[model samples]
Target: MTSRSEILREKMEELIAVGALAPGQHLDETELAARFGVSRTPIRETLIQLASMGLVVMRPRRGALVAELGPHQLVEMFEVMSELEATCSRLAARRMTPADHVRLLAAHLACREARDASDPDAYYYKNEAFHEAIYAGSHNQFLLEQTRNLYRRLRPYRRLQLRVRDRVGASYEEHDGLVQAILAGDGDRAEQLTRSHVMIQGQRFADLMASLPQLAAGELLAPGAAGRTRREGAPAP
Candidate 1:
């Protein structure tokens, strides 16, 4: 069962994704508590959770606000996420046990089902499971935790990527290749395939930009826009 904090976080994320809460909008604890029929305690906790996910920014005196990453910042995040995922895949190829293989295969199968059903939301959840399997198969606790952290931070943008034309189908094919490489215990191939699968570059990045105009009536920042800077204290890795 989902905790109160988790439910509140999900609702807040939906609001942001649907543009009901624009970027940099202040999150009033009292209002959210009333909206969710909970006390301010859970709302406070939920803001902290969202802050850790990079979806909310908590300033020293400004309280909590929705995070708004500029295009360059978003790309920087994707680059780091790509490397983390590639590392996980490489280690997974070397360390995955029989049970790990079974779990990963199951997740892939579920992703296939979601794709075939043409449900982007369902596919998005399954895609998360598929990556989680890879992270677990790495068998490195620190790496798994770190990758999961970055993965959570990138979740919203990753979901948006699926809205790109034919992206879900292409992503499924990439997963097939990754699974085959990992099953063969080919760490090099697994690293390469996973990197390509996760990295938003060239045509894929362009396609993502093209799809964003429909997201919020030009509210989303375009690449090369002025005043775009990386998040303070965010690691460049």
Candidate 2:
């Protein structure tokens, strides 16, 4: 079971991910502690945890703020993620066991269900499981660990991407192709398909930017704007 700190951290992360906690917004410990009905200790611990995940920025005197990635950084991270996923797919094609194939198919089915339901949040978790199955199928412990770490860091952004119009359907189609390639033991095809599926460049990147305002408005808004407050350079929450 998750502890209160973990739960609070996840809630804060969701707020940031959806833009409820805007970029550069300071995290006031007192407010957060009051909001969550907890003491400042758990809030502080949660902030530290989020900082390590790249979702929170902790400055010398600025305390904690939501981390924001510039356009260049976003592209660079996506590029690395694409390549890592491609490598995993390639190795998985060659090394995956029959049981691994079964699990991958199950994960894909779960994603399809979530997509059909038009549930982005559900699809996001299912998507994570799908990719994780591929990582495990790669049969390389070090590579799996690295991929999982990066995947976690990229989770919020990736989840936002799925909110793009038609993205869920398109992603499901891509997963279908990737699953087939890996199952058929076609490493080259699997690598190419996985890379294309994940690389958010060209038209895809443009589309993401176009959709940002909508995502920020629809998903990121707090109950009342006035209820959301931040202090610059405040003490650690």
Candidate 3:
């Protein structure tokens, strides 16, 4: 049987994924526990773990709420993702095995095939796979973990930008450059290319926010915007 904490965590993750709990929305313990058919203890423990992961914030005397990313915080995350990917690419040039190279190449080909087929979702998944293969090839657990966390944090933003016309094709071209750099063992070039590749998403996000005034207003007014000070009632993470 699943442990209480695990079950509660799954339920909470589901809630977050489905938009039942929007960014900056407070998490009601009693309501969540009741909804999940669990006790408050598991809910409390899970909330703490989530908060530590930057998924929620726990506030003093108040409660837990989803972590909100203001425009600045989103930019910071993009900056961090760029650095992480660059470092991973640089290290991967030194550490990648022949098998790793093959896998990365295959992932890139998969993305190319998907892009040629005009399957945006498939192309997106394959593109992620290509980077993930590179990340795993870097062979550093700490870096791997950091990359994974940042990817999750960037998911919503990524999805928002995915379907813009020609975006997938442009992304594939960027990946082509990244793969070429790594294949040639040009570590500095690889680092530069990967970092720029990741930052493109930041640019896309800024454009998106500018185009959609409503979303900007929502983000600006939302609690805990831009990774600011923790709210006392914010969920644990």
Candidate 4:
């Protein structure tokens, strides 16, 4: 069952990821309470929850502000994430069961369906699942937990990647290749593909950086922008 606190937390995370709440924006408890039609108690709890997610920074006496790990810090985190997920892909190639192979292919197809619909938001959710399938297939509980933690920390940054031109289609293509390599039990190829898929550079990195100013100037969000913030298959906020 969904609780009010959980919904509020998800809403706040969505807003932060979609750029509706800019980096370093102050989160006033009373205002958030009014905004969600809840008491300040849940609002405080939600902010604390987001803090744990690396989405909010709570100050001792002054409430909270959105966490602002700038581009450099984010890049550093991506470097770690790249290595971890690459290891997962490599292990998955060797250790994955037949069931794991089936799940991975199913996730790939789901990504294609989302791409065909031209739904970037839908693609985003499926994309997470696609990567998670590989993580689960790795059969290493400790590594899986570490990878997922970093991935959760970087969720807001992925919203930037999804906006890059042709990225969703390009990402699907990358996933196709990765899936092939893994299913063929090519551990080296799977590791290499996973690294490239997670780490951005050259033109794609430039596109992501360029999108930021546009996001700040209020240009990148399309009509019905709230949908980007909602969880997949949930009603639009």
Give the per-residue lDDT digits (tens) of candidate 4, residues 1-237: 877777777778777766676677789999888877899998988888889878889999987988877667867888899999999999999999999999889889999999999988778878888888899999999998889877867775776788777999999999999999999999999999999989867777777777666554435355665444455532122
Off by over 4 Å in 1: 1-22, 60-62, 213-237
Clash count, predicted structure 3: 16
After superposition, candidate 4 runs with Cα above 4 Å error: 1-4, 215-237
Least accurate stretch of 10 residues (summed lDDT) in model 2? 228-237
Order candidates by TM-score, high to low.
4, 2, 1, 3
Specify the highest-lDDT model's number: 4
Q: Give the TM-score of candidate 3.
A: 0.75
lDDT of 1 by residue, 149-196 (tens): 787666557767887879999999999999999999999999999989
Better of 1 and 2 by lDDT: 2
Model 4 alpha-carbon miss at residue 198, Å:
0.5
User: By the TM-score metric, which is better: model 2 or model 3?
Assistant: 2
